[model samples]
Target chain A: MQVLARHNVAVSGVEGAPVIVFAHGFGCDQNMWRLVVPAFEADFQVVVFDYVGAGGSDLAAYDRDKYASLAGYASDVIEIVEHLDRAPVTFVGHSVSTMIGVLASIERPELFDRLVLLGPSARYIDDGDYVGGFSSADIDELLESMDSNYLGWSHAIAPAIMGNEEQPALAAELDESFCRTDPDIARRFAAATFLADNRADLPRVSVPTLVLQCRNDAIAPLSAGQYVRDHVPGATFGQLDASGHCPHLSAPAETAAAIGEFVRA
Target chain B: MTQRLEGLPADVLCGYLEVGDDGVVTSANDEFLRIVDRPHDEVVGAVSLSSLLAVGDRIYLETHFRPTLQLHGEVREIAMELVRPDGTKVPVLVSADMALGKGGQFMRTVVFEARDRRRYEQELLRARRAAEEAEGRARRLAQTLQQTFVPALVPDIPGLEVVGAYRPAGDGSEVGGDFYDVFQLHSGEWVVAVGDVCGKGVEAAVVTTFVRQSLRALAVQWDDPSQIIRALNTAMLQHGTDRFCTLVVLRLLKEDDDWLVTISSGGHPLPLLTTADGEISEVGASGSLVGVLAQPGLADARYVVGVGDSIVIFTDGVTEARGEAGSFGLEGVLGVLEAGVTSAGDLTDNLLQQVLDFQAGEARDDIAIVSIRVQDDADEAPAPAPRADVEAKDRALRALQELQELERLDEAE
Candidate 1:
């Protein structure tokens, strides 16, 4: 286990086999990528770590003002890569983490070879020219709902997690999951994750990038994935036939095949 | 070791089934047949996927289900009430996805028992309702507490009529602390005061009550308006909490044909005066808020109120009340008085209504207004027109009186 930014990091597989660092998105810890990691563990070094404020991480180390901006997370990635002494490393990030990976790679291009950004969103709000599904007022309502139902956070967040109505309601499981987290920590992490805007960093990534987009991801839409592709120069875009936000859990075979081929190529 | 799939017991698998794109049932495990209460061969190729649903379930599947699948391409673990061949309903959760091939597409659906979820949902609904009720009760209690701090109506004064009003800051949420009071002092001098505390909630309300009582006590002993304010400021500084308050005090004395008003202000708005001729102006005051600094420097100004002349004293909630673009401020107060709300009750109600209208019913601060009209005392023997007016009218009478023999000489001639 590796300690990254006060988090307990678990790394498996062989050393120097094209290190694929898996970065998970908001609300979830590193365990969401468990199904995808095993596929590459035999041939490549698989690195998985919870974000400082998530999963089985040390909750005491989470700083509010420091984690207020996504750049703080991006800086943590750079430090993690530096500590591993791995250059030209491939980073596989999901949801908002995809944007964080891109920002971190741009800051230190020599440390990374390529990026695999899954379900990326440059801006969640709709402006005059951009429509990222939700509006400022919508997000405000979401925040109010979260605040009002703070005790039942898991159940409250289920609709937001499964933003697509196609999936069955997981309110029961979600409510239980929410109970696992300390309400104060979850509130702070929620503010940090959903409230961040990382549009400016998308253009700065000079590394070869790949976006594995789900066809009907409720949390992230296809247009948002296309926006990421358009912004990152020479970035490859691949649409997958997966439904949920966590494709590794829903359609592991397709996600593994796509990620495997992209890293090999 | 009997290998149960993934190292679990064989009986654990409640139900499992696979369906084709054309709604044909191709395969089913033992557990699936047991859940549907049907014979294995009887169910195969005989029933469509929608056939398993009841009439109500079919409607949901058609409207909310098919549209979501068509747009998003796949769905998983959605709860449904399945209809058995015996016409009995069973709750279950279903998950399915589309597989793209050389031909077109195929659907794979899995169903499981939903006993746990149904119970959990019922519990969640119950808890949510309870929480909502508690929140509603808290809001009502806060509102009731807020009303106690404000008076329902201002008392009428004889000889000179009086009007007063108050508005607390609230926007569909918690209440605030804004207070106004008019009490007759022991010396028959009426003391009118309006003030706003710094913060909100029960704490501010407590301080407001204390201030109201303390100022009333000080007014009884002190006749000078500025001295009363200074004494209140000292009392607040000594006994006040972390929160501060802004106050304005006015002392009214009945003068013949006019009323002498001694005004003292502490970080409060100036009083507005409307003359009998319909001209309006703000009676400005210069002082700091009470309980903040050691010496608030209370400033007192006097004004003579003639017959039909009315003066309006109010809190910032009146002046700061939002208009269409700018604010009501001193201008709105003057405009309301100019409309001729002469009686105490009318003036109070009209001014309060004007503020409420200007704010568009969104008053986020407490406001207080007190107005008094001066009555002309024409019955007090008229004061004999003074020595200056009498001296100017008759200079010849004075000169003739100065010449000692003027009256005798005039008679002899």
Candidate 2:
């Protein structure tokens, strides 16, 4: 399959302009950036796509061995950018995707001009002296929490949410499905996201970087974000007034404005 | 109506709470206040609903639950926990909806106590994990048992090259019935056999083990290919196995500069013979099914294969493999052979890869292939001396001829 089709890539905004790709985090699809996408549509060409197992992308494309590490996700990003034939493009990653962008930029630094890391944590589990906010038990509890919410991820619900002809009203009501994923895929993704430690890779980044840290974020603690900033050379840290792991969802206007300032500069 | 509306909080069985877009609790019913073990005044307009949840559920709310509510306008049966003032957690099922209220927009949530359900689910989860572990153990055991049926390494014959490949069907979680082995018999001949049992899993594995062991034992005592297979069939019947098998056996013996190959089949696919110029044809005769009929039809076909000739034998898994176009039949095998695969390893590897590609990398049946090729004379540069066994056999034949001549001369005198 074409990399663009494999990733379910959607490109919009001004053509022939500098590109900005938006990559969502663990729980949601590209719709996580729906509120912030319009802010850059008039000036820069915008790109948004779903990871293989998360959204409308081909579920058959999810190979367990390939996606076992962050590097596999990084390859997807590199492929998408290469397909666009637009080098030195800006990448905006949230949550686990932050490391994905970091790995991608490190591998092919020429393909990326800048990176915007939103609520990113280099590692979720605390290692020795470094504080990553949650313990290993907390991650297990988080998995259990996910298990309890399997009702939202049923395959039976996906077709209806994707726009079933028999249930037009229900389909129309949820035209923009967000945070819907296969339960098994979600469990693996959660493990990959939480168990990964990319602290050693931060210094290898060569692109201009921006770290957007949200206050009181449960998933990515402030220290984790600061660690990313401190380790990545010439990285700028911007604190958002929003409180949550997903500032782009909770406080979109502020989130977009912060990103806009960094990208334009 | 006003009085009923005011009394609904106290009358309802489940807990209810309303929070604004900012997630702070704006209103709480008496049932909710009781569930949290907090006074009504302390909860309403004082604390955020997220703060009332456990840490894991709090993360779930921000990452999954809240985004789901915002995009779909409602979320159903989300499992979460509510923390009490005493730091105890109340397991609950929450359903919330986004609605436009008198004060801009708010979320109305209903909480149902689910301690029993949570415990039940936990048990189910544990059972599922245990079953998965058991299946993993079974799969590994099956693989180990399967390795015993095939030779770890094919004995290196001086003039002949041999290669074998096997792929289990599906995700390889269950044992497949197909097996192949290349081994040297005590009679100074190489025997190659490929067979498929009637089914899969541990049951088929049992039959495969029996067949492989029987063939090895029979090959050691018997020189004729047909006789060895017939003996194996008799052994299976005597053993009273309900399963049946299809097998093809080839015995190779050095004949001067060429190798004489004897092929026999018991309801197995015919082995293909490829010439140096890529001409492909079937070599073995069609035989009856094994372990069923009292008198099974079996025959041995012989062919002399010289340098740059190959004999490819495989289970039905190869020709019967279904794809988008159709089953990869004998024509597909011939097509691959016609493409010019000169070596035994190349023939086996290419045929397996072609079959897998035909089926889109998902093998519905186990595939086993064995190929034997007589190496080209040019490839064996400095020719070595003949083997001692062959030399001894030649000397014994010459001695018998000279003794017969001497006995005839003495009788004439």
Candidate 3:
């Protein structure tokens, strides 16, 4: 039988319970949130879907140009939340997806209750009067590297691109699935997600926000996390014991607990 | 005439069967002659096995086909060009299975055509090559554009000497966002600034240019360095994206007959100062980085420079440069300075050279370093006496004048 594209968006708890939408960052699909999903499954309607070209979603839905920016990913989150017809959903995003969720919540404030940003950065480059941790030069070098190793674009770069180094090995059979993406689609998504800057939308987010910063992420450094807190008005900034870019992959239990308490409150 | 095999299924067994010891066609089914396209009488006994193959297939059959088939009595899959009597060539996968007699000697040969699979494989190879070429072009263009933004040399100034160097990052195709500019402010004071923007590409570069230009304007008109950072912050807030940038700006003033360097930082690394006595120290200004926070306070540092002292200002590319084990950091910068201890003029060249050597001569990020050395003031020197030869000439002229006076007196007499 031909494999059918299916997205299992489930709500296991009571119907009237609060909704929590888990948006995964680049490189992986909604599967990264699996470790944290079970914690809230009993109390909240946990919504998850493959972002266009990832996981079990229809591969035909991914457009190279549209997904070349975080805005496109943010649009997907908005659509999924609205489709579920949930009120005041809580969005928990990792890495650049945090900015994605922020932009989405800013557009439709009534759709979200609070934001749990895991390793968020408004900008990655250092400016004359700002310290974004990495500079334009650093990012340029990274992009150039990806272009040079086009043949190893998926199998080689994708593994090193996201998640944490503490858990070096792939979780199980996940590595194959991670590299199984269409390379061209992954390239476009990488360009869009990493290169995007959403500092402007930080002030526009009227919803309550909880920024869970990884203490030591090579990708999202501490300075960038502080920038997110400083810019987003009334946003709570809390440093986690996590060490890598994907806290959900490394320390999901603690990450989920933090999100759960914020959502319940 | 060759007899047609009656029981052979046409659709399932589209391939033809060639029967004989020398591989001459004894008989074939309807599908067999249709695939190879040969007249029954011509190919039945007279045709050599190699007659159906093109030149390439003839070479393959001679070099790789006959030996394996005769010795092993099995011909594995071999892609060959099949030649029709009409002189047209079609690519086909040829697999010959040798059917053995009671004594285990070869008897009949069955050849199956894999025309469909060959066409699919060729198409896949062509598409892969096209994609590779496109990626190569994009990488080349990105590298070329990145080179265009980096300045070849720092500006030349009298009294105070300045030197600058920029190293691009490891990834050749991505444009670096690290930039540094040393220009004489409109007020006649020299303003030197080095900063790293938040990300890479054309957008970050636009911000780099805006920040560089804004710094120059503010350094000329404004007095306080922190106020200039504030102005830049306001300007960036007006049109800048969510991304912010960090930088270190220094304004050099000729105060008390010696150079006084006023340094300001917006979450940038402190400037390293090397005195004439070879004492090295870091000037600290760790305030909040610009654009990240509203009304951010920029840290300002003031230090006096004696004659021959130097100040080195650099972006994180110089400090966080990845050597064999991650980043080299500030110690790497100081180590280079300590090993090759020299004045600012030589320090800039030596420091850049050391960084190049440490990175194995290939820079991974845009590294911008500006070294300013205070020199001995020419105005403090005493005027030199006239040369002895000129003095002798003056004495000779006086004697000639006295002789002329005597001659004139004789004339008057």
Model 3 agreement with the true structure over B1-413: per-residue lDDT tens digits: 99987656755665555545444556566655666687677676766556576533442343235433432344534556567878776656555646755533333444566667656755764677777775675565455444434343455555566777766676666667777776666566767787888888646655665676577677766776776777778777886577688888888777655777788888888889887777889874666777777778776778778777778888887787777766778888888767644556577777777676778888867777888877666723242233533443354344345435545755986
The docking quality of candidate 1, as DockQ, is 0.02
Provide the lDDT at B39 for model 2: 91
Question: On residues B166-201, what C-alpha lDDT tens digit does candidate 1 reach at each position?
Answer: 666655346566777776665766777877877876
Report clash pairs, candidate 2: none
RMSD of each: 23.6, 11.6, 29.8
lDDT of 3: 0.67
Please state the CAPRI-style docking class of candidate 3: incorrect
Predicted candidate 3 versus true structure: per-residue lDDT over A1-265, tens digit per residue: 0112333344565567888888766656666776788998888877776677765666767777677788777777777787777767888887777888998998788999889998888877777776676667556644553443343334422332243243344334343354235657766766675567777889888999998887646556788888889989998878877545666755678888788778888
Give the Å error, residue B119, model 1: 7.3
Angstrom error at residue B182, model 1: 2.5
Can you rank all candidates by DockQ, best first? 2, 1, 3
lDDT of 1 by residue, A1-265 (tens): 2446466577799987778899877765675676688999999898887777675777787777877778788888887888777777899998778878988997899999989988777777666776575577655654553444343333322333355443435432222222134545656655565566677777888998998888655456677778888888888998988754567655678999999999988
Report the number of clashing residue pairs per model. Answer: 2, 0, 26
Tens-place lDDT per residue, model 2, A53-149, is 9778889999998888889999999999999998989999999999999999999999999999999999999999889988998788777766765
Q: Write down the lDDT of every candidate, Cα atoms only.
A: 0.69, 0.83, 0.67
Model 2 chain B weakest 10-residue run by lDDT? B383-392
Residue pairs with clashing backbones, model 1: B77-B95, B169-B364
